[model samples]
Target: MRLRPPDRFGSLVTLRLLFCHGAVDFNVGVTTGGGGMTGFSTSDLALLLYQAAQDKNRWPVLVAALQETANPFDDDAIYRNPAARRELLDQLLPHISQALDMADRFESQAVSQNLLDRTLEMLPMGVALLDDELNIIMLNQQADRTLAEHEMLANHDGHFKINNREQHKLLHHYIERSLEDGSSHALMLSPGNPRSVSLLVCPADLVKDRDDNDPPAVTLFLSNPDFQSLIDEQTLTDLYRLSAAEAELTRDLIHGYDLRSIAQRRQVSELTVRTQLKSIFRKTETARQAELVSLVLSGLAPLRGRESVTAKVADDIGESTGLRYCKGAHGQRLCFAEYGDPQGVAVMFCHSVRGSRLEVPGGDSVLRDMHIRLIIPERPGYGDSEALDERTVDDLAEDMRCLADHLELPQFHLLGYSLGGFLALHCAARLGDRISRLGLVSSLAPPGKEAGKPLKGMMRLAVALADKAPGLAETVLDHMARTILKNPRRHLGSSVDRKLLAEPDHQERYLLALRESCRQGSMGFVQDLQAVARTPLPEPSSLALPVYLWHGEQDGQVPADQAIQLDRWLTNSELTLLPDGGHFFIYSRWPQILANFVAE
Candidate 1:
């Protein structure tokens, strides 16, 4: 029999013939006869052939059909008639050829696109392609960083936007014109700044061998003067065999600093600076400063100095690296930080709302001296911890349970600060005898009419929104998180906290922690607010363990009255009021509080 083209009608007719013939032969159950095979039935072979035709990759199915009987194609004689076997092969070969051709095409396209994306990522300046609607069709890694760092340029939901209205209008007008005429345009944003933001927009059609159907209309180039790919000084010294001072001078020149300015900054004579510069030239094999800087930038310097602070267990923990994570229930990441001695008394500390594991203020020395192992867990959606949607205070308790089990602590002291107190109480109640003691520091009470009375400023507003309008609360918290991430020192903490962070070392530590807290963005904080608003917090009376309440007399976020209320509700509880301490009393009074936690 001759084969026909695999058109819809032809395929249907062929399928119908195979089905009918296979059914007739299968019903007869004949072996070594003219109508049927010896081992593999005709009906089974027909069904396999049908499936292979419908499938995308036909070779595997064809192979399986052949393997249905041992030596079906040879001595076993699964096919009693040569005509039948010959007919099936004629039908299957076309589809197998088509599938092979398609696979080749897909692999080629994927390889080409991957190469393009990687090449774009290597460029120092930000690059983006835009359609006529100003929607971002594609943006490279540098462009993503640029959008994050600059307040002016934004890529909102794939739409490119400029925050400043007048600048937006001007840039839009130019972009539209460029799209129409296939022209190029340039604009300077924040021109008054010493290092201004430069934007260059050109028509995409100018590029050679452009796609014909619905191609990108505009190409945008972004250059921020503040943006620099910093090469590590160690890397420089290792690569060029330069001394520490020579590496410093090389870095300065690469960043566009002149010899005289470097001399003034180093408090050395211009002659000494020139001598160092000559040495750098000799080491780098460069004739001039410009050549040296260009050579450095053109090499691996542009890709260096990028550091990631996210860490895991058993890794060498750096002083600046506070994010240590572990797998929690459902394999979600639960990040926390350890303070005090590694072998000290274990106290699982719950961080407050809008707080990270790094909020323990007095440094690790105080905890070490007090012999307390402070295990501060970033609640769901906070810091480096994975966000759990629709989470509750009870869910946070479960996370604590997972963390404790992960650390192999059968029983440990528990403490909570601010909103964390609610989570601590929940854990204490749920974990039963596992919790040795419970401590609340400037903690909030169960939800009530007067629950939010003591709250002020953004905190008060957030609670109100969480109660009445959760979506708005998330938006507000997201904005606040971005602001905090942008400038932690300016946006995080109160005036008093800022004063405490006045020392550069203190400021750096605080800022780094704050950044890590918002690293996963505002979802963690939003989850906290939603949990607070909806979940019924555990009452103080439910927990049988000894409760310790430490409240600031001037506490503003959660009132001192709440601590008094908690003290009265608990059957066995001790309450302490700090006359001078406020919401942040944990920082100053942590040593004493930690000592009390481990004490009998």
Candidate 2:
């Protein structure tokens, strides 16, 4: 077949180009935007026209500008010209593809950089990136702070010496190993400084997709041992659902002590200790001892300690056989110990708000051994006593009235401690005709702004914070214990009695009382504080009964001034102050106080 030269602007230019040099009869077509012609050979014509356009210097400028500009093909002049449009599309398509490829690479690089930045920022420990030759590539913010603080990393070279050579060696070994194995590794680091930090060293290579030839980098997570102290009490309490007693148990458990050892230290039987442990386990959902220990170490456990003397007292009380139950006003069940003839002088002993009938210091032995008829009712929400729907001094007095009626006693002696003291006073006032004597030991009266300013503030703050963020209760309590309870000069002191208070046995009882109160959902504390803030007392005047008040000079929570104020307010009342004592002075000097009360 004879070959014909392709005509300029040929309609079948593309088809001729395709089959002219071959036997294949394939037909090709091309379409230009301005649309002069479309056939098998049109693509060849378009290519020629585009090449001609490119020969002009304006083609490179136009193509480069189009690549740089936002929307290149939307220009009207390029769309209108047939040759210009074809030429532009040919050039623009390849350029646009190259530009898109570059943009994708840039975006991927940015995303990776962002991920690396976020990872570094979130780390609590210092992190360093090093090159294969041991040159510093980068240092995270934490690393910068640490190195700058220690005067290390002064030079850009990766030759900084950690304060502890042992830790540094270990870290270096881990880094070397991770580089060799191309796997993530870890090590512990301890700096010898006062801010002695415990650190976990981890290989950073796990975060990146890199080969063995890539230099090893490490991330160090710093932990402060003292940070355990900073954890709030409420947080621990809520986290572990710890009652006061369980908090004490947790402390012993964390110290690697067994339940029996803890029981011995607290002067309680092992079974009692086990019971407390079971309660703790149920609340915290911990089945193993190790998990409990970890919870304590992580500050997820509450503050709990053992009190030996209190536990001993509890043991003695548990041995008592005589048990009597009386129905108090407000439908409360009051349990008491009945000894001697019922017709004899009836004595009613009220324990502190955080106390139960079984926890009246030496009341049980005193009543049994002295041949006295004592009516020791478990206060509302305590022991066998029914929980009060509402907590108020008036409600407590009403309850007492019911007990008096239920027991059918015409006259009775009244004794109370701390919160019990205020209740005792109310009982005396309400049952003036039926009471014989009134005694207050380590008792607190109603608190006014001047009396309990700090305490009231603390309570208000606690309630507010708890309401705002219930999770922080344990943390708040922890801080309060350390700052308020641990300070000897403050309400909580380190006197002999105070030291004893920290004992395992004493703490167990204290915690038990607290836990019981909490379980009952009795807002006795809040109500008591509110009553104290509101109640007003009169000047000393002769009463129908004799009143005696006892307090410790060093009493912190309820200042000795409160006792003095009560004494001055009651005409028949006399105040006896104890030296080197505190809120729970009666516990330490129980024998002497009881002797005086019995003699009277």
Candidate 3:
């Protein structure tokens, strides 16, 4: 599709090009308008685009142009009527979606790379195939079309040649050197032209269907400075179901327009823009505009094999748990489960000895509503994480630092229940800079520090064995894993705390969570009990991180006195004492706990 010269037309021509397949963009073709449009005014841009819209193949290009030029408020004149612009956008979405589907289908076909040659035709950049002798074998549609419009360059006998003598000789030398050395070379092409162009000569594997003895050739991947593949507003609208204003806000945000500029450009009050920005956040499941920008820039707009970004996230990141594994310093695989908003306030949830990644009753909805990203990271030797015999309580903070670095979480909140609380306290103290707030619910004080009462019955005996003899503790845990705890329902009435399991549904949830926790082995269970009795943690008052301590007054396992002592030890701590609460006080206060996550 060759673009006609502006002189040939009665009006100014603004021809934006789009490669519907991948996100390849070139800015030079339509230089006088705006993004893809080469910077033209609203009415002039619309007329020029309407002229190209006559061709059915140019619809996606027009959509791309409409999206790009809508920014900076100048092109708002074209889309002055909000309803018309919205109706046009709604109509344009399905056409581009259909085009992408066709493109994807064409790519997966068993036919040889003749499709690749055809696809290069759709790319906006000037692509060329050359041999060892610098003789052009083929040029994609853009090369032919772009060269035809150029004055300093032309296609002579199917080979690219510069009109200037020195430039032609230099281009020839670069191509020959690239083919001979099997490397890549690049140069900028200007020759006092209106726009400078980036020219790259890179060695490429022979295209399929080539003769067996074909000499190694080079492919030129020219870059057009004006070509910027912005987020497809259609894809964002389809993915998030955002309103026209919301979608417009999202597009402008990705293009580096700040909130104040966006408000001024959109001709709306800052409050309205802020409202739309918030709506975009909720729809995209992101927390801030910074994240919204990153989400779009990361190619979350389904342009490739996937149909939608949300679907792509689910497929790759997993559903519910969103399980992921990364190697620790010792090369042990540490597992972490992610859920809720991807770019919300990150809160790490440390697991108990008898818990893995499963959320407690009513926890999921609360986290989702609170806009908090709960990160459930399995400790050493638990769940899918590797069991390290030498793994101590202090090592947790370092491991989590690495994990947070990988996930790009600079600072976040931390929550730990029961045995997990010990790990949380140590983490907060060690990683004081990274922790914004810390919550330890029904958490244990140091082994013998609880003043109310010691653990009773089988739990007392188990703790004793764990402290005196870890080997025997593992044996007992293994036996319980294979027999008593294996069928949680049968022992639900007696084996565990009945007060915590007052309801049938609670019993069932506990059972499932119990089963998932012990899915790997009993080694972590034994090691945890030993750590509970012997782990050395930093003094609470020495730490500066804000802490929230919640415990039940009537609790038997870890008594209320532990919470009191913890509160007293921490300089900045808030103690919430539940009068009739048990070790499982969190199950009833799930909503309140999540609501309290947000604060000044």
Candidate 4:
């Protein structure tokens, strides 16, 4: 019998009649009487059809159907009998499985390539795909822009070369070495240009690129150092702790402006400009003008929103209470109280170990007379300030720099009282040129076993607790604060006799300052105690600024010996030994301190 004509796809409907007749005949052991090959039986008959097609017998219909197995359903494989359809599907199963695997692999590669292209497009740095010959086989958007900006990475007729002959030769050597050893390497290239870039060459074997039979040998990654990518104002402020005026000068100097031009633009005298540059140099820790510019272009710090000490003084300070804030590193808050004239010459007041900003009353007439913008910074973990577990004298000095920068003061006078004297020296050493002059009032010296023996008994106890068990120190100070609040005269002790606390106003102010110091706990007091114990402070003799050491001859907290030693150490210094003053002399003698610092 003749089968129906094949469709264009060479497909056929299910031939159930053939399977019904043949399977039944084979299973039941039935055959035609002629005993010819009239009835089909077993898989032996299906195998013969496959062999006939492989041997190129005249079986076009069966061969074509095998070739179309991938699209069998789409080819409309119409069969008249269900038995014939099931038999044909079983015979074509092996060919259909192979076709499915081929399609899956094709789709996977297409998706992978698309994702790679998109990712490369979004990169901020330049990237180049290089071949064995060091020619750029591929590059991304940033790479193209970089090449256009700087002729260092030049392209000629679709090949890339470093413009500098020396750098070019170096690039060749590195690329060849990477391919030879199948390793990765990195190098920085200056190309004798204003800026530089880092070139990272990784072996092709390391990257995930399956489609490249002869993969590119090396990949070069480049950083973009465009001329217009200068550090912003806020970045400068946060990074170097520079004031608005200082940061502006830094920007001008970085862009190659001379002192005269900067003065012309800012409408100030050249002397003012020179002073501002010196302040910028001190803050950024660069000694030369060229170095300052280089750092701004290449090594500026990331902005962290660290405003200068003056930024929020007017806004955050309560007009009635004189309370303010200064932000520290890592989102820490520094509590300070502002007193005196807002626009007056800036003078910082660092409190004694047992005192807060209120050590001097907020609205004192003496401070206003000197026209001083009095800034009293609470040390870490003091007053309403947050506690820092890791604090160093140098770190505290850096915080003071941030405070000065915020206040927009390029130069200021510095005063450290008691333990604060140790920290005052720290800042003076770091920023000697910026300080007009330095003054220490009964400041504690680094402990010399014999010299430190005369320190107050109560202070010694506080130091022991802070050094051995800080948690306990906090508790003790808290209790002490409460006691002082209950009865100020009793807690006055030897630091200040009951005579000072006789008036209600004097008692009230003294108690208020104590409350601020101990309100947050004893962390600040303990940190100060621990800092004084730090050894090998920078030499007072080495400082560039003048230092004044004042001590009470009758003092017990810090004896007269400390001032004598400081006098011997400082190159530009004077030791003023008071005849009958005590450790608390600063509260009474600040007017004199302010007058001396304000004097030329």
Model 1 spans > 4 angstroms off: 1-231, 234-323, 449-461, 482-508, 537-541
Top candidate (lDDT): 1
Better of 1 and 2 by TM-score: 1
Instruction: Write down the lDDT of every candidate, Cα atoms only.
Output: 0.66, 0.55, 0.63, 0.63
Error of 1 at 586 (Å): 2.0
RMSD per model, one decimal: 20.7, 30.4, 30.9, 35.1
lDDT of 4 by residue, 313-412 (tens): 3232233446788786545787787777777878798887667877673235566667877788888777777777758777787788888877778898
TM-score of 3: 0.45
lDDT of 3 by residue, 144-203 (tens): 766676666777887777788887788788878886786777877773554667788876
Write candidate 2's Cα lDDT for 443-548 as tens digits.
8764443332223323333333233322232232322332332232333433645675775555555554445444333333434444554455422342547888
How many residue pairs in model 2 have overlapping backbones?
A: 41
lDDT comparison, 1 vs 4, better candidate: 1
Better of 2 and 3 by TM-score: 3
Candidate 2, residue 478: how far the Cα is off, in Å: 12
Model 1 Cα lDDT, one tens digit per residue, 364-463: 6677777778888887677767777666666676777888888888999998888788667777888888899999998877665433344444454455
Task: For each candidate, give its TM-score against the true structure.
Answer: 0.50, 0.42, 0.45, 0.44
TM-score-best of 1 and 3? 1
